[model samples]
Target: MTPTRKRRLVAISMILFAVGVATTLTVFALQQNMTYLYTPSEILAGKVPADARFRIGGMVKDKSIERGQSLTVAFVVTDGDGDMRVEYEGILPDLFREKQSVIATGSMQGDRFVATEVLAKHDENYIPRDVAEAMGKAHQKHNVPEDAAKPSTY
Candidate 1:
């Protein structure tokens, strides 16, 4: 084969090899770090795997907190239709309170969720910015007061 043709073939082979290696690495990384979000109802319905790490988001059940020794606090998080007990051993967010929305990350053990991290949703009408406009329009349709319908700026 001509020298220029041989060089071109070698360059193309190297590019193909690099692309294959990159794709393989990306797939491996994704497999090791994938997680899913589930509501309390989905968890109770057996949609979440027992040993897989995932996120659960819902409202904190009223009067469900049980203060344990030290920094440990146990609470039940509910998504209207179902509830799951969560054990967290750290300082909870300042905004963490009854009936507030929260998202917890961890794996399930039996029927309980052993949370490794917890994040409390801020404000009452805490819709995403993109959805806020739609929510505002809907609230106006129902004649909700402007201040009452708006979320707390806190």
Candidate 2:
């Protein structure tokens, strides 16, 4: 083959290889960041896989919060249909309060959710779309009080 043709073929091959690598790396990064999502009702219904890292979101149960030693805090997360106990060890956000929307990412430890990271809504009526949708479904299924499933402005 001609020298110019050989050079063009080699360049094209290199470009294809680079694209393949970039695609692979992108997929790997996404896979690592992916976490299973569940609501309290789903977890109570045995939908959550044991020991699998996942995210659970719902309203923080009223009158079910307790602070322990250091930064450890225990609370109940409820989707109106059910409640799950969550244990977190970290600095909670100022907006974190009872009846507020929250999402906790962690693994299931026996009957409790051992959270690695906890996120709370900054204001009323500002819940994440996923959390709201999940809670809506659970509330509809169980006929839970709309006020209980909602993030209170109070």
Candidate 3:
């Protein structure tokens, strides 16, 4: 109706539009870069996205490790109730071993987890906080073996 009122309305509208655009762009960027964590049980239940880059934390199943040419190694990451196979092409950590808690970062292919990086627990009786919590929950939910349920210092 009035010239001053019209100018003020236009200014407010432009400010709100800029704020909306900035918020949308920020959310899109974060979505693209986010890497989530998962457990073997979640993978088995088909809760994990197949194409998204994510991290898996669990114990290295006993007698489930295999060595291939060079530094390539394959192992089973288990969360008591379920097991997911992991393939890594780099040197494993010195602490890596069967029955140890580990976190692998990668994507899933078919039923196998193709890991780009693997991290094993550092100290005896000490599992990474997040890995320990997830494994403990999984162990509680299923009738997993006591040894498997316990996070060993692998």
Supply candidate 2's per-residue lDDT for 7.
Answer: 100
What lDDT, from 0 to 1, does candidate 3 have?
Answer: 0.91
lDDT of 3 by residue, 12-44 (tens): 999999999999999999999888878899888
Q: Against the hidden true structure, what lDDT does model 2 obtain?
A: 0.92
TM-score of 1: 0.78
Where model 3 places Cα greater than 4 Å from the true spot, the runs are 1-5, 144-154
Q: Candidate 2 residues 12-112, lDDT tens each?
A: 99999999999999999998888977899999989876768999999999999999999999999998889999999999988899999999999998899
Model 1 segments beyond 4 Å from truth?
127-154
For model 1, what is the error of residue 107's alpha carbon versus the real structure, in angstroms, after optimal superposition? 0.3
Cα lDDT, model 3, residue 135: 76
In order of listing, the candidates' clash counts read: 0, 0, 1
C-alpha lDDT of residue 100 in model 1 = 81
Best by TM-score: 2
Model 1: lDDT equals 0.80
Please state every model's RMSD to the true fold in angstroms.
Answer: 8.3, 6.7, 6.7
> What are the lDDT figures for the candidates, one per model?
0.80, 0.92, 0.91
